[model samples]
Structure formats: structure tokens, C-alpha cells
Target: MPFLLAAALCSVLVSVLLKLARRLEVDVGQAIAWNYVVAAAASMLVFAPAPSALHAATAAWPALVGLGLLLPTIFLALAGSVRHAGIVRSDVAQRLSLLISLLAAFVLFGEPLSAAKGWGMAAGLAALTGLMWRPSKGAISGGAAGWIYPLLVFLGFGVIDVLFKRVASAGVPLGAALLAMFVLALLVSLVLQGWRLARGTARLGARSLAAGLLLGLLNFGNILCYLRAHQALPGRPALVFSGMSLGVVALGALAGMVVFRERLSRINLAGLALAVLAIVLLARG
Candidate 1:
């Protein structure tokens, strides 16, 4: 339970760090690249001696590689989503990823879905619809791309979750698997950023680097807590993870209102309420 709470807190911190990065004029791309680098380093330190057994656990290699390719795109989409939509709306949209993941788990892994889970899914969908129902007439950036980014982010994260579960179940030590995954993701991010740098389009200045490092550290904390939660409770990580997601979104909403002075529309407020109820149902499930 304490581990779950830590995971939730870490998730909240990640959201807050991202919000701070935006406020500080940090280059999102560079920061994201640096974030992966730091996160890889942190994971290595946590699981120092890369075990030879991990080599034998190569059955999930393809999935891990695919995940590596998807990760940077996920971050890019999430950053873009936050840029176009506010944090509250972006997070609300992002939580919809859970539905995708749950369905994938059910179909691919044969995870069971009870009546409570069904109710939870319904509530979550309601929340997402409410959040996205923007009635105000204003020119939002990214247009159609804005909507696409969040959905892509959701798909990417769902893929990662399914892959991670498969890898973990296939005899890979959680620590080793996490380290390898982060390292691969970092390499992908670096190559992408390097290409941008070569074109003189990417900024690698001090502020961006610092923000990236901070975001990376926070991300490391989140990964650590998540891995630990999974390790400690081998079955039904979804409940704990759903709780963490709710905590992060709630905290993000609060920060949005307090620090950014962002006003929530009636629809958004209703979305928040529905999200809370969905999490409760999820936990019960």
C-alpha cells in the first residue's frame, strides 16, 4: 500500500515537473531527449549488474524494441497535447489510455473483466467525453492534430503496458527489464534529438538540459515506484495503477488551477468528478 502511494506521488511529481518545464520556456523536445538519458542512467544505477539471465529472456525482444520506438513519439504527442489543450484536459484525455490497455489485456492476455470493471470503464469514458466537449468558441492550436496527438499518446502507452506485462511474465527480472527498456528508449530519443541538432533546429542550451534532467529524475522515481508496486503485488497491478493515475490527474488539475490560474469549464469540472468516480469503481474492481 505504501508502495502504491509512493507511485501515485511520483506520478503527480512527473505531471508537476512537466507543467514547470512548460512554464520555464524549456524546449520540450530537447528536454524529453535528456529526460530519457537521465532516466536510463537512473535505472542502471538501481539495477547495477546487468544480469546474463536477461539475455536468455530475449523472447520479448521484438516487443521491447517496438516499445522503444514508440516511447519518444508518445512523449512528443503528450507534450503537444499539453501545449494545445490545458493540463487538465490533456490528462483527462491521457487517462483514456487505460481503457485501451484494459481491452488489450483482456483480449491478448485473457485478463478477466468483472461487472465493476465494466462500470469503471463506462465512468472513464464518460469523463473523457466530458473533458473533450469544449463548447467555447476559441481558436485552439494544433486543430485536428491536437486531437490526434492525445489519442496517439494513449495508443503508445497502451502498447507499452501490454509489452511490459508480457516481458515481465516471460522470466525477465523486473529491474533488468526496466533498465534495458529505458536504455533502449534513451538511445532512440538521443538519435532523434541528434538528427534535430544536426539540422540546427533543436536547442540544447543550459535551461533545457536542466529541465530535462529534472524531468528525467522525476520520471526515474515514477518508474521505480511502478516497478516496485508491480513486484510487490504480482497480481492485479491495474487497481494500484489506476489509483496512481487518478492521484496524478487530481494533483495536475489542482496545480493547473492554483499555479496557472486556469479556469475549468463546467464540462471539465464534470469530467474531473467522473474521473474520480471511475477510479473508485476501478479500485473496487
Candidate 2:
């Protein structure tokens, strides 16, 4: 339970830091590249994932490479979402991404669809619609920009989940897959950062460096604690899943509404409730 709580806290804190990045003059791209450096190092130290495992005969190169590409790309989208949309909607939307994976399970992977999951999917779609709505000007500063990034976050994470499932299906260990993905993602980030530096669009800043280091720690903490939570409650997968998801939504709502003072409409609040319901139904299914 402590691990679950820590995981949820770390996840939301990542959003909070991103929200503060622009104000702090932190170059998010540079920070993200550095984050992978720390994350990949932590992966190697903690998981000790082998370098050769990535090229094993059974390795799922497509999925691994896709993750390598998407992790950092979607991370940028996540930063945009946090900046444009309030943390509440962004966090809920992220949790609701499981709907995409659930659909893929039924359609692509031939998993049996249950009534609860069907209802959950329906509610999740509705929740997404409502969450993306900007009924009031106070919802977010930019009208369309508010929803676009959150939508991207939703879709991008959903696809990442599908890719992760593919890697899991390939029988490669999760730790090895993550390490490979992180290393590849680091390389991708560096290439992009290098290009930006060459074009004079970005500069190396101590602030960005500091933020990136902290971001890496929080990001790695989130994954590590969640994994530990699952290990702690191996017999109760639902508990860990629900705890992590709901905990994020709840904590994010508090932070966004109370601490950040972000505003939302009644419809948005209804969407929040639906998101909670969808999560419960999905967990039960």
C-alpha cells in the first residue's frame, strides 16, 4: 500500500513539475532527454537488464522500437497536456487510456469481452468526451489547445500500452524491454536535442538540467513503486490497479483544484465522476 501511494504521488508530481517548467524557464526537451539518462541508468542498476537480451531471437523489435520512440514523444505530449489542460482532466484521461488497451484486447488479441468491460468502455468514451469539453473560459487558457494535448496524451498512452502488451506477449522480461526502450529513447532524444542545438533553438541550461534530473528520479520512482506494489499484492491485482489509478485521479484532483486552483464546469465534474466509474467497472471486469 505504501508503494502504491508513493507511486501515485510520484506520478502526479511529474505533472506538477512539468506545469512549473515554463515559469521556471526549464527547457522541457532538454530536461526530458536528461530524464532518460537517469532513468536508463536506474534501469540498469536496479533491474540489471542485459544488453544482449534486446537482440535475442525472441525479442520483439517492433514493439521495443515503438516504445523507444513513443515514450519520449508521448512524454512531450504529456508535458503539453499538463500545461494546457488542468492536471485533473489530464490525469483522468491518462487513466482512462486503459479503454484503448481493453478494446485492443478484445479486437486485436481475441480476448473475451465481458458486459462490465463493455459498459466500462462506453463510460470511458463518454468520460473522455466530457473531460475534453471546455464549457467555461476558466477551464483552461487556450480553448482548443486545452483538449488537443490531453487527447494526444490519451491516444498516445493507449498505443504505448498496446505496444507494451506486445512486448510482454513476446516473452521478453519487462525489465529488459524497459531498459532497451529507455536506451533507444535516450538516443532519439539526444539526436533531436542535438539538432535543436545546431539550429540555435535550444541551449544548455543549469535549470533544465536540474529539473531533468529530478524528473528522472520521480519518473523512475513511479515505475519502481508501482512494480513493488504489484509484487506486494500479487494475489490482488485489482486492488493494486484500482489503487494506483484512483489514487492518481484523487490526488490530482486535489492538487489541481485546491493547490493549483484550476477551474472546471459542471459537465467536467460529471466527466470526472464517469471516469471514476469507468475505472471501477474496468477493474472489476
Residue 211, model 1: Cα distance from true site in angstroms: 1.0
Rate residue 137 of model 1 by lDDT: 60
Off by over 4 Å in 1: 1-5, 138-142, 229-239
Q: Which candidate achieves the best TM-score against the true structure?
A: 2
Cα shift from native, residue 201, model 1 (Å): 1.0
Assess the local accuracy of residue 205 in candidate 1 as a C-alpha lDDT between 0 and 100: 85
Best by lDDT: 2
Model 2: per-residue Cα lDDT over 1-285, one tens digit each: 999999999999999999899999999999999999999999989999766776773559998889999999999999999998979988998999999999899999999999998999999999999988886556468778899999999999999999999999888877898888889999999998999999999999999999999999999999999999999999999899989999999999999999899988888989999999999999998
The alpha-carbon deviation from the true structure for residue 67 of candidate 2, after best TM-score superposition, in angstroms, is 0.6
Candidate 2, residue 213: the lDDT equals: 99
Candidate 2: which stretches are off by over 4 Å? 57-59
TM-score of each: 0.88, 0.98
Superposition TM-score, candidate 2 onto the true structure: 0.98
Clashes of each: 0, 0
